[model samples]
Target: MSLYTTTLLILDPDPYNSIDRLYRRVIQQAMHVTLPTGCLDIFVARPPTRFRETHFVVAQLYKISAELKQLENKEDIDVRVLLEGVGGFDIGDARNRSWEVVAVGKSDSKLLPVFIAEQHSSWFSPALQIIILPMERSIETSSRLPSLPSDEDGSHPPTEEGPHLGEAGLVIDSTDEEGGDLDDEGEEAQYPIVALGGTFDHLHDGHKILLTMAGFLTGESLIIGVTGEALLQNKKYKEYLEPFPQRCAAVLNFLAYIYPALHATTDEINDVYGQSVTIEAIDALVISGETRQGAKLVNQERTRRGFHALKVWEIGVVNGDANDQWAGKLSSTDLRKREFEKGELAKGQGTQQKLE
Candidate 1:
């Protein structure tokens, strides 16, 4: 089967209904058989006027994460989710203390693939060699493809009955013009400098989301604090931790790939505060919802230092397969443990083969 470096899928709002069957076919035909290098970017098309609930968007993201973890082949394909017609999803509560909206362009059918290919051409092939569409829309959509030659054409059949968005815990913010809630003046807030901290080991989709949000909010620079060995000593599978330099490089390389325009810098963080308290220029801090308390502590330190408190923004956790041992929030420690186990299993199999 021919392999594609980059592929695009235009999906509906409720993609969880068909995610399993859809990805199964995608992996079999379009993906690299041995080692996958590029990403499959899925743009979920929402009605231009309808408000996409933040919880529903997060649920779809976790559903994709869980499905990828369940695949036996485990080709390690990187999948990214983007919503159509919405710049970003604002997930904060009434006080807006939770998180800022991570901005993305409104999807244009004619320009989606072209824009992606142009931006990623430096790292991966520019052509979107495979285009996957819903079965109902495949025949009509095929006629609209750009001049690029496609290796394969694929479609997914319609899904069976599924729960309604509202029934599945969706909250509609009808007052806001877009996906996010507005300020008292009815305008979205923008920060010039944003900072976030993480281990960024084995950088995966979860890390990618956090980085993307921070970069999106940043108008001047995105400051990242990668945990140093001193801070990672107690982590599970610490034996497999990537060197500090490698971890920092991986985070910067990914930022360049996704947000080429973003001015980003990384620091080795031995302490939890990192540069968030030290740097007086930072306007906001982006963190995972699970790390809200950490953000609060950073603010306390900033206050103690006589600097103003930075705005706090939280991104929801991306979860892995619930049935497997790696289930729960997508974690780097779990990934390291998985690699160790795989190596051990290989060693045992090799010994048995030699004896036989």
Candidate 2:
């Protein structure tokens, strides 16, 4: 445990790759590959076939994100953009009306990426990080993080020394040394594009880390997106969590209290130079470390289209109760049994007499 080892990986896909192409990008079919855990995310590819956009195209995403947040009880939905093609408001006006309102806009190239990442993050990873790629050739090709070597012994190596007490018995600086910096940037860095993605089911401690990281890095308002139930239609991972509607509500609850335009915050998401940059106007994105490769590629695509390539910002992973027996992959049948069993076990332990 003296020296810890963790590496960034990039998954390179072959055009002839036989792997289900659906997993390539975020889409409605996510439930297929992903387990039906209420809080997990899976990406899918929208095979390029032109489809007409309607009023509520991307509107569902914001609603979903907000609902998911509410279900978790944290209740803070910050940023979102939709692909409403006609019957509703445009992306620029995403926040003019409440998430409850309908929107309208054509499915632009950028909206899909945002929608996919958030929608999936709400369920798959919980700690959501969304990265949307404008449907333009920003980069020639994309890459992924190198896969890690699982411990053959069936256990993970110590990432670092266990937490240690500090001055006044405090757990001082147990964090990784190589974390993202807060104040490193220039003009180009200020207004850089970003790729945002996630499955933010029960926004927990780890999820907050990701959000904090994104806000710190961009120094501006962020853009968020998620998948739709119509697209998330049939999946495997939906057992022990709230549905999309509830999840999005949780998120919006959190955002209102924190950035409620009336709250007091020292570290506000100011513009590149302290300008007005709130959720209604996003210039950057917040993403999870679990999904850097796909996001990077999308950013590259934007660059090719004469758009600012996104500067990657990271939220260090935070831990949550999902590690408990109650939370896990969703099954069509009985997945909640784990939670029930754990509860029974606790009850039995309480009644057992302790031997002196």
Candidate 3:
């Protein structure tokens, strides 16, 4: 039924007269829901002879909803409450924190009490109609098993950690005017959806480790975003690095055999700059929390451009190259600098599988 209609029915007089005593009124509103953790009492508005009684019930209801959701680990707990009077419910107390929705209507102050139940049930109407009834609570599973094997020295297994199948994603890095082909210039992305990014001027075992991770992450597609040469060089040495397309081609060749996504975009990735790319959508952006700042910047830009905020997931970093690779050793810029010349550029193929 429409919410307005339901509100009217709910506001109707109680089937049994309950004006004489407070005990009778309290019993009338004691609806309960059974959950795995405990039983939650749903409150219907009780006519309070005094204002203090109204305050007491409000405190009790908040405690109940908070306890229930805490057990479920659910963030989106909507509180469709009926306040005792208009302006009775405080927005601060009922917001995204413990509640996602609150539909309040007429009462003492044009407000009703909090929602009586969390679930709706289906029912039959007197006019020979199917009336869906509402419910309060239910028991549910909290944990699930992983899909991919965590062991090493095994064929790549599909994992939800990296990319999701058929999730549309895009990657953009400015390209020079090559071959003078407009269609070939800047195009939408394609899939096994590999997104190879970061400073490629020093593509080391860390890069390879990430490449291996991507192969497992996106089984059918990949997009290599070379982040313009200016952008990369600007990162450290303060100069344009690979001049864009060359970096793309280098990453492409190293990854071409394992990657299925053939397209790439420029700084315009995530539609912030406007040009669009085609390919599997990116379900998650896997990175070490080191890039947390950059990721947050990108996400903020996405929101400003009226796009969905990204669901960025952070992964732990593997140590040196040996660890980064199936060899299980540390491999990173710092380690590379300690061994080889600092800032020296290198490139090679990434592993085809996650190591032991």
Candidate ranking under lDDT, highest first, comes to 1, 3, 2
Which model scores highest in TM-score?
Answer: 1
Rank list by TM-score: 1, 2, 3
Error of 1 at 134 (Å): 3.2
Cα RMSD of all models vs. native, in order, equals 12.1, 23.9, 24.6
* lDDT tens digits by residue: candidate 1, 1-356: 44445444444433223333333343333233223655555545552232223333435554554465456354376665544433332111101111111112222244444445444544433323324322322212222211212133311222243223332222212223322222121133557888999999998767876775566557778889999878887998888888889989998976665455568899989887999989998888877655656776787788888888776665656653223532577688788999999989999999999999
RMSD of 1: 12.1
lDDT of 3 by residue, 3-94 (tens): 11111112211212111121222212221112223222232344232211222233233333444454555313332223322222222222
lDDT of 2 by residue, 1-356 (tens): 11111110111111212112211232222212222222221111221111101101111222233344444442322332212221122232322322221111122233444543544544333222222321212223232212212266423232222111110010101212332121112222333222244544555433333443333233333444433444343534445445666555655454442333212122212112121122223355444434434444544455455554334443322221223532332221233355556778988887784531
For model 3 the local lDDT of residue 309 reads 43
Give per-residue lDDT, candidate 1, residue 332: 87
Off by over 4 Å in 2: 1-195, 217-220, 230-236, 262-282, 319-356
TM-score against truth, every candidate: 0.64, 0.33, 0.32
TM-score of 1: 0.64
Backbone clashes, each candidate: 2, 88, 58
